[model samples]
Target: MKNIYLLFGICLAAFLLNMALIKLAVDLPEFFTSHLNDLLCMPIVLSICLFIIRSFSRNKGIKISLFSACSLAALYSIYFELYLPDNSTRYTSDVIDVILYFSGAITFWLVQGMEAGRKSSAIKKAA
Candidate 1:
């Protein structure tokens, strides 16, 4: 839980910094301007989803499942990268963004695993 919160905080902070840079008209590298949001999308989104799920469910220990996380990333990638670009002039398809979405998903999964590991370790210690 603490690991997820930390991950969420870091991602959220980076995201806010990116937004602040954009709003302030600060010139930044293309990666920061373009890909940072893509890289951050899933972890932040999934963390919020996990928070909601935990809030509503009887099981507070619930985390986003790997399959669900990857599936969402794939769906979001396709929607933003494939579908939107063809449908709207405002959106351009970027393959790199698709890769970043999956990377974010994997990051969330790894951090969530860390929290699980920590819980197990605590349980073992308590025993």
Candidate 2:
């Protein structure tokens, strides 16, 4: 369906952005904590996911992109956790980062769900 293509594009963009931001986190030697630094892509990815879901999904929930988003978040998080030079600088990948990734995905779902609900309600009122 048309929605699937949009979801795929969003996922691809999120993956690319996440990868780039991971590199940024690696090279940036700053005062910020690792958690804060690693969280840079949270909003971007979530926004992309949420936008695609809201525009594409007509259902009440984020069923269409749920598995894709969650799996991508998990696998991407694990990849970065293992490959990134976090340990050298004490930016170790704890369970919390994984949680953050999942949280980001869930947050995207919830926000889009709310948007969908509002749109449906508006349509009903207008009708």
Candidate 3:
């Protein structure tokens, strides 16, 4: 859907901009540098995944369920926050990051639903 692609583009652009700011040493707020990526990660990743699933299944009307989204957030939290921190020094455990991941997932679900609703309404109006 156009809305999904637009949301994905905006989130991806924000993530890239955040990374660029960090790389350029822009000295922004701590949240922008540290937590923004975590917040945007799921929406960006999940949108792409959903698009691929829709394309392959030939079902543009399909949407990711809330349970699936939250489950993914939980899995990411467990692996990246709980498991990786213990196994690798590159990762650190952060409870806030877990919250952000869920927040992003919910955001994706809300946007997806909005798009679906609009499509249904348009169909109804045409009929």
Candidate 4:
């Protein structure tokens, strides 16, 4: 779907920007590469995961459920906050990351709802 492709583009762009901010440039604010970096990709990753799960699922309605969004966010937060931190020294465990993950998940849910509403209106107009 177009939206999925767009999400991929956004994800790729964000990742590149994060990398550039952290590695290529020296004078840029650390917030962009450090604190905000964890926040930046959360929504994109969650959205992509939701889209993929929805596409593969037998129940199409599962895509719009808040549970799916929250579950994915929780899983992501646990992995990055707990498992990854324990396994690697590059990333440290932070409670704010979990909060950001929830924030991103909520944003994704709202966006998806709006997108669905738009599609519905378009279909009604076409009919």
Candidate 5:
């Protein structure tokens, strides 16, 4: 079903965005690296979750998926922190990441609801 595609998309976008952010970190100065991660994490995760939700269903499914995405992001963050060879370990633990996780989750849920509402109304009109 489309929901399956949504899940896959969530995973893929997260992977790619994280990769890109990693690359950006290398180019950024130490001063910018920490704050940049903070500002960037939520929008990237939320964007993916919202896109997936908009592409699929409008029900609680979207909310559940958004929450799942947040969990996955957190796990991925922890894994990368402990496993990945990088100087950014300190940046990962910054409280900003935690806030980003929740902000991203909530933003996605709201975006999904709004988009789903639009789709539902459109479908009703066509019917």
Candidate 6:
């Protein structure tokens, strides 16, 4: 639960920072404005999903497995990139957005694994 909270807090801070940058008319690169933040969306949403699942289950803060995380990420990417873009006037259809979403998901997966490894090593050291 502590790790989950830390991960969620970090993601939320990042998401909020990005949104603030956009809202404040900060002079960011066009890519940052258009695509880079999209790259952060997966970790943000994935962490939230993990937090919700762990909060309800009595599993002592077990993170979602890589397969489950990837599946959910893909589902979200599809919804945002394909369905939403096609259906919503606000969201323009862009192939790059899909790629960015996957990149973010992959990054989150790697980070999650790394965090687990660190914790395992630390526990071993303590023992």
Using TM-score as the measure, which candidate wins? Answer: 1
Steric overlap count per candidate: 0, 0, 0, 0, 0, 0
Candidate 2 lDDT over residue span 1-127, tens digit each: 3343344356566556555776777563342334443343444565555557767878535543667667877776877776564556644667667777777566555555565678779899999
* Better TM-score candidate (1, 3): 1
Cα displacement (angstroms), candidate 6, residue 125, comes to 3.6
lDDT of 5 by residue, 1-127 (tens): 3443464466456556656876776574553444444434554555555557756766544444566757866765665544453555443445555565566555555555666677788899999
How far does residue 108 in candidate 2 sit from its true spot (Å)? 1.1
TM-score of each: 0.96, 0.53, 0.95, 0.73, 0.46, 0.78
RMSD of 1: 0.8
lDDT, model 2, position 83:
57
Q: For model 4, what is the error of residue 63's alpha carbon versus the real structure, in angstroms, after optimal superposition?
A: 2.4
Ranking by lDDT: 1, 3, 6, 4, 2, 5
**In lDDT terms, how accurate is model 1?**
0.95
lDDT of 3 by residue, 1-127 (tens): 8888999999999999999989999999999987999999999989988988888996768899999999999999999999999999999999999999999999999999999899889999999
Over 4 Å off, model 1: none
lDDT of 4 by residue, 40-106 (tens): 5656776667667888998654555678777877998899899999999998988987887787677
lDDT of each: 0.95, 0.58, 0.93, 0.72, 0.56, 0.75
- Model 4, which residues run further than 4 Å from truth? 1-8, 50-64
On lDDT, the leading prediction is 1
Preferred candidate (TM-score higher): 1 or 5:
1
Higher-TM-score candidate of 2 and 4: 4
What are the runs in model 5 whose C-alpha is more than 4 Å off? 1-33, 45-64, 80-92
For 1-127, candidate 6 gives per-residue lDDT tens digits of 4544565677678778878999999998888788866777777788777767777899854766778766776787788777997898988767787787777677677777777788889999999
Judged by lDDT relative to the true structure, which candidate is superior, 2 or 6?
A: 6
Which is the better candidate, 4 or 6, if ranked by TM-score? 6
Global local distance difference test of model 2:
0.58
Instruction: Give the residue spans of candidate 6 off by over 4 A.
Output: 1-7
lDDT of 3: 0.93
